[model samples]
Target: MDLFDCQIIPVPLTAERQSHISFWPNWLPRERADALLERSIAEIPWRKDSIRIVGKTIPIPRLQQWFGDPKTSYTYSNIRLQAVTFPEWMDTLRESVERETEERFNRALVNYYRDGSDSVDWHADDEPELGFEPLIASLSLGAERVFQLRHNLTKQRLAISLPHGSLLLMGAGIQGHWQHRVAKSKAVHSARVNFTFRYMNGR
Candidate 1:
């Protein structure tokens, strides 16, 4: 889709403050998106990472990998991910995203949801390493899913249906005041992959 086709959704943060989300429902054409989805599932080295919760080790429902400068690492929920240099295909995708969004992104956290049961819990991408008011560009491939967001203070919420090849940008300041998650669904049986592009300091 062209840049002018973007859908901007306003997110109210407070009485005076507001953030916004830019969504492109058809960022990539179906044929290309289908090929990418197949390549991602078959070629990428997906990792099975677990988190420690209340002294118990539990495997995360989804598989993920971090790609960026090899020197940079990301840690969240007690799981540390050492950065892997982006492969040629992924780097090309990143560059395309940069051009489309007109934003700089140096890192990507790619997640593979094998089925409906695979999901991510509500959380904010507010790590110190990301600096303040970070912009996140998320690209979805494969099955459609509901991306849910909730205000941290006011408890207000929003949900967006992310379809295959869609792109969504979480604007600045939203991370500080809101959390998002991809919840599990009983009816969805297909797989999905998401690439969350982010910028980091000292990249």
Candidate 2:
């Protein structure tokens, strides 16, 4: 992995305040971010394949991949995913997330979007396994992508670019109140990996 000279800096996430707990802290040194991303690609057990969405099993938006656990299999939006054990790098990252959210995470669900064509629709990570008032830590690495949110009923919108090394945290109430999505782009070439850490009680 190429070493970046820039330092990992955290991005401020408070622009306008909503009732839900949502945060975007991007402070990772650029170099460290590169190293962590490279290490993750090499060390994490990422897999390439298709998944069922809606009602039918379909291939991901593009050449998508994921790293998670067998028991972590949970599905929504026709997407079935397993939770993966945390890699050392991710474990360290998780600690930071824990401090930020003041909660611990046992499983991680990572998504890789190869380019602009790849994206996720507006959906909340409010699966049964995620528990009530779940704290989801989403860390972005690689290309910059837009993260969007809208009120479930009111249709109010909020959007931000989750550049490499940025972390977006949706704490519990956000799911009940909002739906988020990663919109498709037209210019990104490199891949973007997003790790959404969660705690599942049963489902």
Candidate 3:
């Protein structure tokens, strides 16, 4: 598949100016996407993610792994994630995303939601290390899920069904205006993997 040859459609999820997001429902071919999903499940070292709340440690609903330059470290939800070298396949994928988006992304945060119960809460990617007006590229694989976005002030919400092999690009000013999350559902029995690429301040 040609990484740059995608049918990207603009999504008007928010009315705020300069807050843009685009979605490509079929960014990748089905066979290749399936193969990548299987390979990721087998080769990627996924770890159970946890968060610290009120001095108590609790496991998050999903598994995650960080890959990038060794010096690329991130802090979120009071947890620090040290970056590890990306595998050969991931490096190639990251390069494709960079070429397609024309954005320099230094790190990829891979999240695996095992079954329907695993999910992420509503939050913005406005970490101090991400710098001002960060651009994020999110790729979804495996099972489909509901991705929700909500305006911070208006409380307006938008729910999107994210399918396998889909790509969503969240542009500048989005984190400042909206919060997003992958809502959980009891009906989904399979797993879903998401790769979110971001540019950091120092690495």
Candidate 4:
């Protein structure tokens, strides 16, 4: 797809302390988005992983698949993930994002939320391996969901409705200051797929 042919604009957010979040409600065409969602569900080797929280082992809410360049393994919440080869479709999409955002990414973490029961807790992408500042490009498909961000110190909050085919960019310093999550909602019964691309600093 030609970058010039696509008109993806960012959705503005209310003024919040040290927060950088923007969204393109329709980064991909509806047909393309649906196709990608179906292919992702069929091709990716998704699996459940658990994390230790407060001395208890609990399964992570959603299924995940981590794939990227060599040595792009990542760890967080005491869970380690090794990098696996990515599919051509994902690689092409990553290039498109880089061209539009003027940024580069070497790793991708995909999350699959099955129905309303699956969700992620509030947390920042501030792992040591991500460096002091991190830029995350998150693309959503299949279903719409609400993504919330809260300030680390000010207690201010912002919420955005992320629809299918949308792209959300979390800019530098955003992760250092703001925490975000996808809350579970009984109203949503369809599945959703989120692809978050990042520049991993790993061995």
lDDT for every model? 0.94, 0.69, 0.85, 0.83
Of the two candidates 1 and 3, the one with more favorable lDDT, higher being better, is 1
User: lDDT per residue, candidate 3, 1-203, as tens digits?
Assistant: 45444444443435645456777788888998999899999999887767888888899999999888887677788678888898989999899888877889889889999989999999998887788978899999999999998888788777878899988889788887889999889999999999999998665
Give lDDT: candidate 2, residue 186. 85
Please give, for residues 1-203, the per-residue lDDT of candidate 2 as tens digits.
23322223222223353444344545477897898778766766666656665767676674333334545576765556565555567778878877766777767777778788889888887877677767787888888988888887678787777878877666557776788898887887788878787776643
Question: After aligning candidate 4 to the native by TM-score, how far in Å is the CA of 94 from where it should be?
Answer: 0.6
* Best of the two (1, 2) by TM-score: 1
Best by TM-score: 1
Sliding window of 10 residues with minimal summed lDDT for model 1: 1-10
* Candidate 3 structure lDDT: 0.85
TM-scores for all predictions: 0.97, 0.78, 0.91, 0.88
Candidate 4: tens digits of C-alpha lDDT, residues 1-203: 54324333332233543445656777898999999999999999997899987989999989998888656678888778887887898999989888877888878899999988899999988888777688899999987999988877777778888889988888777787778999999999999999999886653
Query: Model 3, which residues run further than 4 Å from truth?
Result: 1-16
Pairs that collide in candidate 3 are none
Q: Which residues of candidate 2, in runs, are more than 4 Å off?
A: 1-18, 21-25, 49-57, 62-72
Q: What are the C-alpha RMSDs, in order, of all predicted structures? A: 1.5, 5.9, 2.8, 3.7
Q: How many angstroms is residue 198 displaced in model 1 relative to the true structure, after the best TM-score fit? A: 0.3
Q: Evaluate residue 49 in candidate 3 and report its C-alpha lDDT on the 0 to 100 scale.
A: 68
